[model samples]
Target chain A: MTDPTALSCPAPAAETERVLLGHGSGGRLMAELLRDVIATELGTDPIAEDAAVVDTGTAEVVTSTDSFVVTPRFFPGGDIGSLAVHGTINDLAMRGARPVALTLAYIVEEGLPLDELRAITASAARAAATAGVPIVTGDTKVVQRGAADGVYVTTTGIGVRHPDATPSAAHGRPGDLVLLSGPIALHGTAILSARESLGFESEIASDSRPLHALVAAMLDAGGPDVHTLRDPTRGGLASALNELAETSSIGVDITEDAVPVPPLAAAACELLGLDPLHVANEGCLVAFVAPTAAEAVLHAMHTRPEGAGARVIGSLTDEHPGRVHMRTMLGGVRVVDMLVGEQLPRIC
Target chain B: MTDPTALSCPAPAAETERVLLGHGSGGRLMAELLRDVIATELGTDPIAEDAAVVDTGTAEVVTSTDSFVVTPRFFPGGDIGSLAVHGTINDLAMRGARPVALTLAYIVEEGLPLDELRAITASAARAAATAGVPIVTGDTKVVQRGAADGVYVTTTGIGVRHPDATPSAAHGRPGDLVLLSGPIALHGTAILSARESLGFESEIASDSRPLHALVAAMLDAGGPDVHTLRDPTRGGLASALNELAETSSIGVDITEDAVPVPPLAAAACELLGLDPLHVANEGCLVAFVAPTAAEAVLHAMHTRPEGAGARVIGSLTDEHPGRVHMRTMLGGVRVVDMLVGEQLPRIC
Candidate 1:
């Protein structure tokens, strides 16, 4: 296991002084901040999972939180409101939990159009209704015009753990196979195109959909053999896989041809000189399944709309434990490392 | 019952166009935003309770969320960190829940000092530890320097419901007695003084504390007799009483002299031309208890440090349903109304 204290020691003097955008990029810097500062001070053990499971003496409850500050607030497939709901729901799903309730908190800037706020609220409500989870309570705070962006949404989700499932990033075994639920980088590409007006907007739409149903299907088929489940969100597929490998103390091997990427998003990534593997995704999830249930899990995933793009991208290995190696399409081996700094900020 | 849709009516054109600081002042505007917009769109019934109870088949879980963006980051009694933790915990406690876990999320401005963030994190950790609740998971997102203040902490707390307690503002009856947990307005006074450099720094400290223990004692003593429990945070005692009166369709009658306000905070409010009853408070709570159980609840409250100033401040009456009135020391009665607009912004 990585020592949480070690992440603090090597932080450069400059990096340790002022907060950087990279510190919230869901990359190495973000990880360092979480472990060295947040975890150490909060006195909680670091776990490589999207949500924490609390045994409430009766039933285990899963909880997670995320803040959405996506610039522009509105995007192609979904707005910040919908994104906020889906993001927290997906986090609970990543832990094999059935989301039960969500709480919405808004940090709205003064002078933000009330009509716009209404629209966002409606969209969030619709999203929650569609997911069948109720937004049970909410809080709103407005700051001075410049004190905050238009609106930043923070969503906290509560879910009940599935009795038959127990999934964790640290549960990955050496022989476990890695699976991708859907095409990668669509959300990242969409946000970048919209923000920079890169003209790829019409072609790429964010895959910002809820993945709890997809997770439920996979859990039904794989049960405890699902080993590990994670939504490749802010740090994307590369970081998700790296986190699992590090937590499980196993190496990962993937084939470049096997990792699914939408053609339009791929072209956009290539044109922008961005790595598709390093881009963020809102809907897709990465799973490590035991060899015995891999095929069944893949078949089950294919039956769900969100997981139609499911495929076995790689397998956990005993070699190079704690690292990921990719077999390039051109027959060359390369180490795939976690992102070091900001790439697609606020994509989710 | 207040018709939720009526709040959306007669909203002046200018008011409907953009959000004002009043919409977040925890007053009438904030109430309208919640009932007319958030609740209506989300298709949920509004309840005058700090937290929502979610039934998970086997257990009832209470959930609440709050965002703290108090300016200056640090204040006399506590910093934003402890406030974040205490605020959410008190929300759950007000709903008669025993906190189990909390999720902390931060939207930090890019240029904030890391040292400041560290201090805040440590303070939050200490606060959570003191409350005996673990901050199980967290998320951090950094926005551009202009996108946010130094840092905003959003805390979501999850707690198990107390079996014998079922408190709600709507449960108040005409015969119920209103109780004050402690001295009020210190938080609002402290924030205002610190923000304006009003030189009352040493004398006034924000009563930013966790009140779950005090709540537990009250619950143990009064159980089902505690009709309503609300933290007089934003909009202070006046707003809290007004909300309870409206929710219960009853009238609240208070004696001005009986309301507990710290001497220094009261003086500060007088000097600033702010009403102590309208100022915010952090640690204190307003409870509506059955008349027969009022003395027992107050005695139990006084047993806890946080509730040392517990006393009867008022009682519910049928004479002026949906209104609050205070009998002045000079033998004059005046109607007290909920705050209309922002008195103090970003106090919590």
Candidate 2:
């Protein structure tokens, strides 16, 4: 566990006199802000997990909340409305929860096209229906024209925990196998294309979709062997790995060649001078499972459309605990660090 | 019940081509948008209550979500952070729920002062602690400098419903007595004063508070006789009464002289050409109870500091169903309609 004292101590006054975009970038700065500011104020050590599991007397329930402020409301594959629902659902899935209901709160700017709002609502409703989750309640607030962007959606999801599931980032142990479900970086690149209006020859669409069913499949197959589950979102794969390492106090060794990055997304990243490993993926997830059940879990994941491209990319190690290392395609080793600054703000 | 066919029909092309601030004003336009646009797409009747109750197998739970976009982050009595917590908690309380946990999601603008964020977080933490509700999960997102205001906080609260409570707006019956928990319009006036920097002879502080304790007391005293409970927020007393009337298909007759309104708030509303009944109140609530239990509920409410100014303001009737009427101080009755447009935007 991270030292409680270290987590509570305030960051240097000079380092964070004001909040930069990086503080919300799901990177090192965001981690620091959450640990030193939010956690300190709450007088608790930061859980640093995607969702919090609470025991509701009769059952263990998981709940998660996320606010979506993506630049262009409509991206290549999904809009902010669907993204909001997918994001929160994904968080609950990461905790091995079967989502039951969701609540949406919208902060809309004055004078937004009613047609646009209607389209977004219809899209959100469809997404919820497709996921078998209902938007049970919602609230809407409007600010002055210039006080806000077109709209911001925040979604909170409630789900029932899988009966046999007990996944946590802190459960990863030495010899655990690390798996990546599908490709990475699609979401970030797609949003950038839409925001910049840069049409590429091969369109990169966001992989934004609900993953509760995929998670349920994995749990049904691997059970308690699945040590940890995480959606590589805002901070992408590198951040997810680093977080897992830090939380479990274990080291992760992975091969760059084994990580999956779609050709178009890789090309887009290269052209934009970005790193694929550090870019966000809305529809993909990473799982740390017991080596004994690694093959079974991978097989189960392969049977699902969302995880058809699942592969074993890494393994937990005793060496260099609390850090992540990646082997280059050339057989050279390099440290995979949490993103240092804002690479792309509002990408998720 | 409203006509399902009418709700499903899209608004005439000429009537609403875009979303106006009034659509989020918690008034007639906002109700129309929710019923005609949002609810229609979801394939469910609009639930005009503060929170939605869901059965969790072993226990019934109530959940609510609210987005706080108050202009001045810091107002007379409280800041946006505390307001966010109190607002969601009050919503749960209105459903007769004992708040268990909360999830907070913050959308912040780039370059906001970190000091401000920390202060707000600390305030929110204190408020949650005071209410005995833990903020179990949270997420933060950041937009570019000009893309958003300083910050908007969305809070989702989860609570276990009281065993004997079955409060709902549709539960109001004819002959039920209306009660005001406290003064009206203090929150609106205080926010306006802070936003416009208008100095009043005497400071008018927002009545921003969590009301779960008072609500519990009322439930304890009135039990099933307490037909409904609502916090007079954005659209204030008039809007709350109108919604109850419509939901129950009953008439509400109130007396302007009997409703509690702080003298300072009344003066501020008069100076600003605003109706006290139409302005918001963050800490107050309106309750409809059986005539037999009215005195007991009011007495129990008066014992609590939050409801010290409680008063019997009106009664429900069969005449003029789905409408509200107010007997003026001059002994003349007049119709009280929901506000037609935004009275004060972003006042929490």
Candidate 3:
């Protein structure tokens, strides 16, 4: 995923010359690494969105890729396999694409149990099938026992762009209404609870499910009015909102009370000293819809099971370009800045 | 890449309950893992080729993926970066597809040198540009230091099938001719020498360049008559031939003297007690062309730099279906079987 924050942040210090865990935290450091190192070396303009569209002569093909190295492998609600499938699929959906196929790749440790690999593979297959896309091709490589974690999966998805939508992070504009599907922080909280053996395991579960169907419904209802669609993964809602604001050169104002947070996840975030706005969510979306079509889009979202909790949380503004502000319950407005570094790594 | 040997092997015993290094060795064990576990659980037919073609309603798109975990990260003639690009491109080329876009994904070990990451990214970019395919989209994830090696890369390539060709592993006929694009074993030997410090590093180099141009030339000359195309990567020539034979349900006959082996690679293989035919290759291809078009294809191959050492090495036969026989230099015939275990791990 592209990090628009790279355009606004100062150059990283020269002596911080090694890749830190923060570089993968979907924060300011990750954006700088991608912009200063990867993009510069590759001589390509920084990618500003989840998927890239390529003209295949006969049609435009949308492509995206992601690697899952979540610790513990077998987390509640989802494992690495389904995560791999759902992650890539959501990336395509963010681009308003209908995924046609996915390619799966695994980097396995030499001593991983056969049963573990089988279970992961089956989970990935079932997820793909349920999403109506096939795992058409794949690869598996084994490294020495100590050379890798149990297994890491990389899935690449190919899709056809939705004809009625042209959603992008840079498409947001003043007056566009922001609508969020479902709740925030469930995924990040579930992962943290599972990883640390926290007692809240039974109370929180990952929202790691596919969101393409919900996205499709939004596009069908709003057509070209669906200006932008984003999934709050990795850096979560705060980073995603910041990226959109910076990329679109627009400001966003949100009503804190309207942002839904599942009670369990909110409690877990509070107890863990984590910001719910900076936590990853797998099965939801943040959409910027033209105000004229907002009600229709929200209605369409409510028709889908994945989007039953959809509601308007904010609206784009022109007051503070490239900034996000929230109206607190205390009636004061506070700037919602992006996380400076990683609060959690490998949450995805 | 797919291994057709799964169609010929007997059922694996239930006692072998854990995954072995050989499961990713590009041999019989790997084939069984794919067929009996991955494929069976996924409810799909076993894949028997390098890439899969998905009809996009408007065009046929070929997709393939591979993850590189070579030890030492850098090796003679190529590093993990270049290997990743060349590997996926070669897979797409093997399917008569002209690559259009590529995706690069990285799983980095925390604390890896930023300089190393930059170098690898630059190398991958250069390779993709050389192949005329843009790295359109990508992803990066960081793991704890001990959770992974320095870095692993998974590249997925998307391409458009050639309008004039339809080459496939199962398209081989009894009278088809087998041609080797160049010498084998250089890649595997170079990696081994680099990894083990075997003193042959100066004398051996990996033939790890992209071969899509050479494949394009062959397709131009033979068109639809080019029955099949495969790059002898992980399992090398012997395994590739076995796969072709088994997939097409035909026998293959080879003259040992006709298969080209560079003097340095041959010496390295001998000193290391390895068979050149059983080692991996990255740049070369094995093209099965009809006898009537063999001369034209060979002539066209000679016009390309990567195919300068190309030669007719074998022919498909009907006598012993699903078997390969090599006539030795001394006039003795022997069965050339697939490698039962890994001769070299992480070779590509």
- Residue B288 of model 3, lDDT score: 86
Model 1 docking tier (incorrect/acceptable/medium/high): incorrect
Compared to the true structure, candidate 1 yields what TM-score? 0.84
Residue B91 displacement in candidate 2 (angstroms): 0.5
Clashing pairs in 1: none
Two-chain DockQ for each candidate model: 0.13, 0.13, 0.14
Residue A252, candidate 3: how far off, in angstroms?
1.4
Order candidates by lDDT, high to low.
Answer: 3, 1, 2
- TM-scores, all candidates, are 0.84, 0.84, 0.84
What Cα-based lDDT does every candidate model obtain? 0.79, 0.79, 0.79
Ranking, DockQ, top scorer first: 3, 2, 1
**Candidate 2: residue B49 Cα off by (Å):** 32
Candidate 3 differs from the real structure by a C-alpha RMSD in angstroms, to one decimal, of 17.6
